[model samples]
Target chain A: MKLLTLNFLTCAIKTCKTNPASFPLHPRDAELEIQEADLNLTFLKNILPRLMWEELRVISSELGLPELPATPPAPADLVEPSNTPLDTAEVTLAEGGAEAQEVEETPSQTAKDLHRILLETCIQEGKLVCGSCGHEYAVKEGVANFLLPGHLV
Target chain B: MLPTPSTSHVCFDRVYEPAEDSYLLLDTLSSPSETSFLQDRFKHANSSPPLVLEVGVGSGVVLAFVAANTQSIFGRQDTLTLGTDINSFACRAASQTVRDAIKERENGRSVFLDVVNGDLGSAIRPHSIDVFIFNPPYVPAELPDLSRHEYYNTIAEGKKATSFQQDSYLLQLSYAGGEDGMVVTNRMLEQVPEILSDERGVAYVLLCAQNKPEVVKARIRDWGSGWNAETVGSSGNKAGWEKLVIVRIWKSAD
Candidate 1:
């Protein structure tokens, strides 16, 4: 399972459905695998608006990734293509010796980090414990077992 | 576009391969009318990126098609596309199929496709799914064949059993649709009210003649007071005259 999927999942127990602590299941002893995938700026920008920014930040921090901004950028800023010449600016900055244009490139660079954190990282094996119920759902061979017992079902 | 079974990983021999039923479901969803209907529904709802789920996403082709198409039009990168199957092999095959499908697409839209190994939509949340798609096991079989208990017992004993025993058990789980072929489909129909979004949520389910589409429609209507079911499309194969029916279910305001 990928960390992205974990964001939407909560404790599946019926009684925990409305429980405030049921969600954002805490991952314990998670084994991570980073596989390189093509970075599509369009895709990353599109998904940014729908992400639960705070929950994502918590997960990213839990996984030891760099901190995401406390608040996501305005939705409008993300979907609309930036006219800042991101590519050209990066090239010019590299030639001018990195430090000079560092501030100008942060937005695009941050987008890349978010993309890597959400899509490229996969949880190969681990257990997700419900914050409310303390029920542990095990992830084996990359598939999380969320099935409850017959009584729970 | 649905990927051919050949495009799936080699281990998918035990997985339910994409067949005529799968293609019919894809064609129904791909129809221009259906596409526009879904687009209009989402546009009107102004809901957050809609959640589209496929129950029993054998090879993941159907869900991939919907995801790719919706992403192209809805232009929402956060649109969640999920698939669930009881079989672990099918789950893995589904992941591979979705990856291959996205890689083959011309557009660079990235869809969040997640596959969980579970029965029907048991793992999913209630009243959260915006679009539901299911292609269930609808082939008629005897009582013994429909017994999940027996199936698991065989699997437990599979270590000492022959390869044939294991293969048969997998086949039974994939194809055996006890009684009128409505066993599994009925179980899923009962879950529609629980999983479907309260407003304007729609489900496309593939049914066959043996499953008695009329009975299934009545059952769905009874499942929800204002819910309605309509036959979206149907096709018949010449060889065995095996007919496939696609039914759309949704709640009516009035």
Candidate 2:
């Protein structure tokens, strides 16, 4: 399962719903894999507001991945400065910033790094243990199992 | 018309094959009226990308369709899609179905999170989902006995394949809703209010004639003031047992 998915999941047990610690399920004995794909800057920028930076940092730490920035990246932070190497609009009318031309901003390393951490990194096998009740959810072959025992349910 | 996501690679013995109910969801979600509603609801570009969650994503036809065509359906390319199924086999098959669908679209593709194995929306965080979809087990049959779920959910230790009985049990989890078919849907409906995003959340649920569509909608309306439920799309085929309709549920300012 992608670390991005952990943002929206919680302990499956009924009582844990109200517990503050039920969220950000901690990863244990995780096996990580990187599957690269084309990164879209717009998506990374737009998804920033929804992410919980502290929790994600905690997860990143638990998975033994590189540390994430303490604060989420701003939309502008994902883009390179004005002198973009891969500018789609190369032939810009640069008449001393006549009307301040709108060129598509190139994605920066920050965007690539965020994409790598959230989308590309996957847990091939692991266990997600809830903080509140200490319930463990198993992850196998990249799919996590949140199904609880009948008694627990 | 949007092309239905292919589930040809899924093993029908263990996963529910896309059927009329699934097609109805496709038709409704892509229809002009529904698309406009979704697009308008999620038009704000700076707002965090809308999260789409689908419970019981058997074969993942509906979730894949939404993920592949998020530009047309939600009017945004950054929509996030997730899925969950009670049966583990369906969960794995659905993850691939959605991934392949997203990969097929060169542009305007949405992100797909993993499809986990869980009951309804039990594993979802509170107030997280922006768009919810469910092609529930609306068949009016005795619900499958889940006593063997643990044993049937996985292949035997050191064995490469699951037994035939396990496959049958897994398939039964896809359908066979008990007692007027509301047994499962009711459980899911109870979680809708708690799981949906406060301001922009919406849900599209498929129900058959036996499920008493009117009563279900009425109950949803009674969720509170401003809580609304309406049939946005219907097959209009009353003769068959699978006469289906898609109910769009949401809340609006008075």
Candidate 3:
């Protein structure tokens, strides 16, 4: 087991050096697609509850996603890190609007529209996320990877 | 053109004296479709003297008509035409039809088909081709019955009816695309990016719409990224209420 771990570690290090995420879609390309969708702040307020915050943070940091809060309150002194983890809390100050009412009346419809816009932007513009899970599904070669290992199930 | 009576004990001029079934199949293909694929070809490149290939050449009806038109307009400019079908009988009939067309001189002389028989992509030289055309066998959601007359039978035979329920149904290598109607179309689209020419041409594919145009279009849109495609022409056949559509796709510089 230790030898296997060592082997995997060596391969990972080599892979990182060779093909780093320094390229576009390194991280935020998948998670921040919702931001590009001409959406209102209400969308973020409503959708924050649906995602895995930690995973979102990791994807955002890797892709250098700015305009995302580092924490729930979004402290003024909280200097943006070289990268931020996706673990920040879901709740943020509400931005009241007609979109919020639309969400209240037809939550499922809103979810679907949000999901579709997210998918289209990601696919057409290199944004990647799962169609069902809202998890970050990396896009490569115009293929959106929605792979879920057995353990995740 | 009128069908001449049997003479000289030799069918030297008729490649296919269409049997009832073959006539119906040819009619299904040649009938006008709503999506005119030829218009797309003409829209992208109107060069009249372009080289064209028609695979699975059935009765040689379309080839005969197209060749005749080209000859009348071009007057004698260079043009290359080839037709290939898996069936030897079909190839023989096509060759005979070309001979007849040449003899009549109504179409033109020196007009010949580079016809052959083999699997798709085989039997053709690489990149030496310009336009690739197909009217692939597309009867929707059919069962594997033991009818020798079926076009699927022309593709492969000997599978038991019980085998149709297996996972290999789609991979039957004949027809049947699982439960959904898009399986065979998907496999065909997957091969298009490779077998089709990328530099100066596109493939014109004809399919019968059996109430699955949306599925077909979605698959086309997905597989066709670097390529541009549109319906050129369409015609309808009364049987099965089938609508045959022609789709011509070209590679864009973008």
Write down the TM-score of every candidate.
0.80, 0.95, 0.42
Predicted structure with the largest DockQ when compared to the true one: 2
True contacts kept of each: 0.30, 0.80, 0.00
Model 3's alpha-carbon lDDT is: 0.40
Candidate number with the higher TM-score (2 or 3): 2
Chain B TM-score (each prediction, in order): 0.85, 0.97, 0.61
Worst 10 residues of 1 chain B by lDDT: B145-154
In terms of lDDT, which candidate is strongest?
Answer: 2
Worst window of 10 by summed lDDT in candidate 2 chain B: B141-150
What is candidate 1's lDDT per residue for B1-254, written digit by digit as tens?
53332344625446677788988987888766677777777754235667788988877877777665655444444456888877666777788777776667676445655787676776566677888998888899853333252244223443753256555566567777888888888888877888888886899998888888998888788874789999887776645646889999989777
> Candidate 1: what lDDT?
0.72
| Per-prediction DockQ | 0.28, 0.76, 0.01
Instruction: State the lDDT of candidate 2 residue by residue for B73-179, as single tens digits.
Output: 88889889999998888888998999899999978878888899888999999999999999988888888876557888989999988889898888777888899
Q: Which model scores highest in TM-score?
A: 2
Better by lDDT, candidate 3 or 2: 2
Better of 1 and 3 by TM-score: 1
Candidate rank order under TM-score = 2, 1, 3
The whole-model lDDT of each prediction reads: 0.72, 0.90, 0.40
DockQ of 3: 0.01
